[model samples]
Target: MKILNRCTLEFTSIPENVAFARVAVAAFASQLDYTLPELEEIKVAVSEAVGNAIIHGYRNRPDKIVRVNVTIYKEGLEIQVVDSGIGIADIDLAMQPAYSTDPERMGLGFVFMQSFSDRLQVDSSPGKGTTVTMFKQMGLRKARARAN
Candidate 1:
C-alpha cells in the first residue's frame, strides 16, 4: 500500500560507508516484522548494492557520492542505491551470473541481490553511473491487520 515513510541518505564512496549503508537500511527496514533471517538477507542485499556502487562505480574513490533512498510501506520496502561514476557498458552481461569485470573477485553481487530481494532493477548509462533498485515484500498482511 501506502508509503508510511521515506528516507534518503547520501555519503562518500568509501569502504566503511558500505557497512553504514547496510546497517542504516536494515534498521529502517526493521520497522516491519521481518524475521531475523529476512533482515540478514536485506542487509546482505544492501551490502551488495552499496558495495557495487563503491567498488565498481567510484573505484574506491572517496570523492564520489553514493546515494541511498528507502521507502517503507505497509506491504513492503523499496530501496535505491545510486552513484555518479563510470557506468556499466552492458547490463545484460553484467547481470549474468559469475560475470565480472574484475578478475580477482567473484561476480555474485547481482545474484545475491536477486536472490535476496523480491524484485531487483538496474539502470545505468555508459558514463552516468548506475542505480540499483530493490523491493522486498513483508508478507505480513495478517500481522499488519492485527497491528492496525
Candidate 2:
C-alpha cells in the first residue's frame, strides 16, 4: 500500500484535549470513508492512547508533551503516539481488560486499541517513555477480508 497522508500534533496533558484529539483522528479517518462505527472505534482507541500518554506517560506533569503521528496509506492508516511520561512497568498488565494505573479510568484503552484496529504495537521502557503504533486498512465501498 502507498502512503497517502499523515499528521503530527503535540498536545498538553489536559482532559479537554482528549476529545479534541479524538476529533482530529476521526476527521482524518473520515477521508478514507470509514464507516461511522469504524470511525468511532478509531476515535476511542486514539483517545485512550493519547490519554495514556498524558496521564501515565507524563504523570500530569503539564510540561511534558504527547506527540501523535498519523499516517494514511493505501491499505489504511498507521499511528505512532509518543510520550515522555512514566513508562508502563508491566506491558501485560497495561493491556489487561479494565486494567489501569489510575483509578478513575476503566483500563480499557489497550483493549480498545486491540479491538478496533487491524494491528497494534507498543514499545516502551521504564524511563524511555512509550510509543504506540496502530494500523487500519480501508477497503472498497464494501468491507473486505484483510490479507495476512
| Candidates' C-alpha lDDT | 0.91, 0.84
TM-score of each: 0.94, 0.89
Best by lDDT: 1
Global Cα RMSD, each model: 1.5, 3.1
Estimate, for each residue in 1-148, the C-alpha lDDT of model 2 and write its tens digit: 6667889988887767889888998898787778898899899889889888988888777777788899987678887888877787889888999888789888888998999889999998998899999987686533344332
Give per-residue lDDT, candidate 2, residue 41.
Answer: 88
Q: Kindly give the stretch of ten consecutive residues in candidate 1 with the minimal lDDT sum.
A: 138-147
How well does model 1 score by local distance difference test? Answer: 0.91
- Residue 90 displacement (Å), model 1: 0.7
What is the clash count for each candidate, in the order shown? 0, 3
Model 1 over residues 1-148: C-alpha lDDT tens digits? 6779899999998899989998999999898878889999999999999999988888878899999999998888899999999999999999999998888769999999999999999999989999999999887674477358
